[model samples]
Target: MKVSIITVVYNGAEHIRDCIESVLSQTYPDIEYIIIDGKSTDGTVAIVQAYGTKIARFVSEPDKGLYDAMNKGISMATGEVIGLLNADDFYRHDRVITNMVSLIEQTGSDAVYGDMLYVDRDDTQKLKRYWRSGWYSDNAFKWGWMPGHLSFFAKRTLYETCGLFRLDMKSAADYELLLRFIHKHKAKLSYMNEVTIVMRAGGISNSSLKNRLRANREDKLAWELNGLQPYFFTLWLKPLRKIRQYISKPPVKNAHS
Candidate 1:
């Protein structure tokens, strides 16, 4: 199956090259790589343009935000499956896409997701945390469990059926999307027990105490907007669950070390 990998970036000149190179280097030949830029003035567009036609599609324009750019990329995607990779993130290995497609075909599932590693922004080799996404359960969302969004690969039809990311949400849009897809809509999902993406340590939701609190409120609103009620402790458990990520480390050889 063909997979379309979308990278949404804004003024991310520093690391856009790494992200692009990672996608271009994928072992999967049927990948349609798309890059959506928010009219970056920091030479991010130039960096991406330097790749020329190697990038299947490139759009640089002013957008509402990260999720908006993602939406744009999704609308342009023609592949059978779609995956999102952030500008500051890269595939764990060259075969990440190859393995994802293989698993999807083998399991006959609508979606597939795997583990992720958060490495230092300056030194990617230095591990910051390990996000090991275990098997999915119907009630897992109640306990604040979600597969890594970067590692998530789903059919394009899922978005057309379930809907796209909410534009109003600041940080919890990804959380909300996953909740709707896996929980509310009950999309068939398969879990791969391996690391797929390596992300930069800092994330918007966990960037600061204030942002974290805001994200918590948005997360609760996510459930409310979907007409689904989460457990009273669900939001609380979400951040607390990260403790395990910090304590745990990826396997020595398997984590792209």
Candidate 2:
């Protein structure tokens, strides 16, 4: 099955090139690489254009925000399976997408996910945090457990049924979409207990205490909008779950250590 990878970026000159190269390097030859740029003024577009025909579609235009750009990419994706990779993230290896395809096909799963590593922005070789997403269960959502969206791949048709990201949600749209599809709709999903994406430390969701608080409110609203009720301590447990990530580091990637 063909896989479509979408990358939404804005002023990501520092990391966008590597992100593009990673998508192009996927061992799965039938990948349709789509890049959505919010009219980046920092020369991100030039680098994307440099890739030329290697990329399937490159959309450069003004957008409302991150989720809006994501929705646009989803609408344009033509491949059987669709996945998103941010500008500041990259596949753990060239075989990442190939592995994802094999797992999803083997299980006939509508969606599949894996783990991620958060590395130092200045040094990608140093793994700062490890996000190991265990197998999914409806009950886990109540406790605020979620798989890293970076490694989640879903069938394109599923989006039509579960719907796209909510524009009203500033920071929690991805969470809401996953909750809606997997928890509520019970989409067929499989988990690969391996790390496939490495994220650069720091992002809008966790950039500040204030921003995190705002995201919390959005998350709560996500439950409310779906007519679902979370455990009273659900939101509180979410951040607490991430505490271990700050202390537990992964094996260093540097050679000749």
Candidate 3:
């Protein structure tokens, strides 16, 4: 089955190539790489144009923000499974997608997920934040557990049945979408129990004190919107979960490393 990997970017010339190459290097032959560029002026378009044929669809136009750009990618995706890869992140290895495909097929699950790693700007592994998304549980959402969006792959039908990212919410749209699909809609899912994506430090959500606060407040809103209690508790649990990540060792990468 084909998996559509969407990379939403705007003026990410410095890191876009790494993200693009990660998808292109996936051992899985059936992959639709979609890049949604927000009318970048910083040579991002030029870089993307260099790999025109390798990319399934490349669009450069002004967008509302990250969430809006993601919505556009979702609308354009033509694959059995849809996964999002930030412009500042890359897959853990060439076989990550291949493994996800095999696991999804073997388990017959509607969605699949794996762990993640956090690296420095130079792509040097700084910390391994293993997202231990264990077996399915209805109460997992209550503990504020979510499959990291970076490594999660959901069937396209889930989006059509539930909905795409909420364009109005800034930082918490991914969290909200996860709540709706995994908790509210209760889509069947599988956890791969392995690292899948590597996120570089200094993402927009953690760029500044103000942005971090906004992300936390928006996270509370996600819990409330999903009709879950423990607003403050969940918010705290979200970041606290990363504490385990700081202790784990980084995985070995191939040439893509």
Per-residue alpha-carbon lDDT of model 3 for 1-257, expressed as tens digits?
Answer: 88999999999999999899988988889899999999999999999999969999999999999989988999999999999999989987889888888889999998998877777777455563455555668767767677888788999999899999887677788889988888888888898877788888665545467876888888888777778676447776776666676676645544322
What lDDT, from 0 to 1, does candidate 2 have?
Answer: 0.88
In model 1, the Cα lDDT at residue 15 comes to 99
Worst 10 residues of 2 by lDDT: 248-257
What is the C-alpha RMSD, rounded to one decimal, of candidate 3? Answer: 2.8
Candidate achieving the largest TM-score:
1
Mark the regions of model 3 whose C-alpha exceeds 4 Å error after superposition.
128-132, 205-213, 230-232, 250-257
Candidate 1: count the clashes: 0
Measured against the true structure, the TM-scores of the candidates, in listed sequence, are 0.96, 0.94, 0.90
Model 1, 90-200: lDDT tens digits are 988888888888889998999999999999999999999999999998899999899989899999999999999999888889999999999999999999899999999
Residue 68's lDDT in candidate 1 = 96
Per-residue lDDT of candidate 2, residues 86-138 (tens digit): 99999887888888888888999999998889989979988788998888876
For residue 170, model 2's alpha carbon misses the true position, in angstroms, by 0.7
